[model samples]
Target: MHELSLMGDVLALVKRDAEARGFAEITRVRLLVGDLSNALPDALEMAFDMYKAEGTAMLASEAQLALELRQARATCVLCGLDYVPERSAAAAMCPVCRFPGGRITEGEEFKVLSYEGR
Candidate 1:
C-alpha cells in the first residue's frame, strides 16, 4: 500500500533527526496530517509497528495522529472573485455570482508540519 511506503519515509526521517540530535530513544511522535492529505492513520500505525521492530528510536515510540483542516479556496467564474468555501468533499458552486463550476485554488497539501520526538 502507499501508506507503507509513506511510513518508511517517515521512519527514515525520524531516524535521521534522532541521530542528528543524539536521542537514544524516541518516546513519542506527533504528526499533523491535513484533512485533504490522502493518508490513512491506521495503516501508518500498523506499518510503523511492523517496520520499527528492533529499531533504536521507534521501538518504544508512540505515534500520535492529529488532524488539520483546510478550507478549500475557490474562485467564482462569473465574478472573478476568490473565496474560501465552508464545506469540503463537494463540487460547491459559487453562491454569490452563481458560477456553475468554481475553480479550486487550495486544499491539496501533504507534508509533515510538526514532529515531536525524544
Candidate 2:
C-alpha cells in the first residue's frame, strides 16, 4: 500500500527533526487521519511496525503510532443540514433535500500532529 511510502517519509522527517534536536530515540508519533484522507489506519500501523522491526536508530524498539480519526462531514446548501458523508459516493448527498451538492466541511486531513523523542 502507499502507506509504506507515506510512513517512510514521515519517519524520515521525524528522524531529521529529532536528530537536530539531539534526541536519541523517538518514543511515539501521533497522526490526525481523516476519513476522506485515503490513507488506511491499519496499513499505516503495519508500515510503522515494519519500519520499527528494521531497528532504525532513531526509533525506539517500543515506539508507538497513535491515530486520531476524523469523521467526514458535509453541509447541504439547499437544506442547511449537516451530516456525515458517504465516503464511496461521488458527491455528498443531503438526506433532507436529496441534493447532491453538499459542501464538505471537514475530513480530508492527513498529517503528523506530534512526535515524542528523547
Candidate 3:
C-alpha cells in the first residue's frame, strides 16, 4: 500500500534524526497531514505501528504516531477569490460565487510536526 511506503520513509527520517541527536528512546511523533495529500489517517497509523520499533533501536514499543488534518484553502477559478470553506471535503464548488471545481491553494502537505525522545 502507498501508506505503508510513506510510513517507511517517515520512520527512516525519524530514526536518522534520533541517531543524530543521540536520543535513547523515541516516545512520540506528530504529523500534519493535508486533506489533499491523499493520505488515509487510519492506514498511515497502522503502517507506522508496524515500523516504529523496527529500524530504530531506541524506539519504544509504545511509541505513538499522531496525525492532524490541515484545513484546505480553495481559490475560485472564475472570481479569482480565495476562501476557506466551512467544510472542505464537501466543497468541490466555491462557496461564495458557486464556481465549480476550485483549485486547491493549500492543504496538500504531509509534514512531521514534532517528535519526543528521551
Highest TM-score model number: 2
The CA-based lDDT of model 3 is what?
Answer: 0.82
Residues 2-88, model 3: lDDT tens digits: 999898888778878998998877889899999778898999988887776464435688889889898888898999889775553
How are the candidates ranked when ordered by lDDT, highest leading? 2, 3, 1
Residue pairs clashing in model 1 are: none
- Count clashing residue pairs in model 2: 0
* lDDT by candidate, in order shown: 0.65, 0.92, 0.82
RMSD list, candidates in order: 3.9, 1.2, 3.1
* Candidate 2 Cα RMSD after full superposition onto the native fold (Å): 1.2
lDDT of 1 by residue, 4-102 (tens): 888778667876887788766565555655444576667767776777664644545454544455545778877988877656436647878766678
lDDT by residue for model 2 (68-97), tens: 999999999998999998867899999788
Identify the runs in model 2 with alpha carbons over 4 angstroms from their true place.
none
Off by over 4 Å in 1: 52-106
Best of the two (1, 2) by TM-score: 2
True-vs-predicted CA distance for residue 88, candidate 2, Å:
3.1
Query: How do the predictions measure up, each by TM-score?
Result: 0.61, 0.93, 0.79
Error of 2 at 7 (Å): 0.6
